[model samples]
Target: MSAIQALSRQLYQSKLPWTFEFNFNEPDYIEQYWTHLGGDLTFNRPINMMSLPSHFIHEPLPGASATLATISHQQALQYMSAQHLQQSFLLSVHQYLMQNIQNNIQLEHTAEHFQMSSATLKRKLKKHQTHFQAQLDQSRLHTAIHLYRVHGFKTEQISQYLQINDTTNFRRAFKRWSGLTVQAAQS
Candidate 1:
């Protein structure tokens, strides 16, 4: 396998979030190759690196020359660590929303925190196949599940924690998310 293919496989198998950086300019064929394998590519100017989510299928690029560069194992590990720290921007935004789930999370608030305009944030999320409200619903559902299962919180408590005004709405939303009523989930 080529280096990029091998690296992509390793990252996917490890199940850790990562961003791949290529030193040379990514030819159009390379981009197409990755895209066909369900990878999203973001090009960085001056750096010649392509950032993508970790869960991508790697296919060999047609007519690609295999140029192997020998590197120490420790250097490879360090490179992997750096890549893990550079997760997709959309994921970082989701994580930020998850951390602030107790408060009323808003797109404007998240955008300001990320130092991007609200439109830019929306565009980025859209590129990643999600929207602000969708992410909020996901975060709330995740938090609700954790509180319900781990802390034994009741529906009312979860609703309050999530800042939902009505427990009935919370129940409905929870059922929609998990296909089970809160009480049903608890039992």
Candidate 2:
């Protein structure tokens, strides 16, 4: 397995919460990481008040001054709140993605229009403790909940509008986001 995958797997399996810091100065290590991990992972400082995933963030490892890094999850909720705040970079991306998704525009196209390199965008979102997949899913969930409860769109039509090809993924993501089924949310 690649180092990033190894790191990710270890992160998921770790029982305790911690933030991890990355050593970004070493071009070789950073290059290998991006190479192995597909350019989505990077050590970057997030925007104001943003936080990172618990597994991949922490204070700099002791005396490791070449590059500061950490491994912790304490900032996870902070990151979530930051992402949810209005006009955050993720929110901007989310709004743009939603507008385009409604028009059937591709994610790559949306990423490009925003002047974000795919890797940079992905890493920034990751630093904020979510993935593009999750953000897109959240956008769809926002639509689903609104239509089901507030706007009164039918499930099938909502599914079509949201571009959720698989009914199962829609249902699963809805429950994951809202702690209730779509139908339950409507009622």
Top-scoring candidate (TM-score): 1
Residues 1-187 of candidate 1: C-alpha lDDT, one tens digit per residue: 1356556556445433334433245666875646543344333221223334433336443434444323455677789898875767867876998899988788899999999999999998889898998888777877886786557788889999988889999988877765667776554
Q: What's the TM-score of every candidate structure?
A: 0.55, 0.48
Poorly placed runs, candidate 1 (over 4 Å): 1-85
C-alpha lDDT of residue 173 in model 1: 86
lDDT score, residue 33, model 2?
53
TM-score of candidate 2 to 2 decimals: 0.48
Off by over 4 Å in 2: 1-86, 103-107, 166-169
Task: Give per-residue CA lDDT, model 2, range 60-171, as digits (tens).
Answer: 3333434223323436656767788446788787888777667665556767887878887788888999988777767776667556644678877787887778777777
Q: Pairs clashing in candidate 1?
A: none
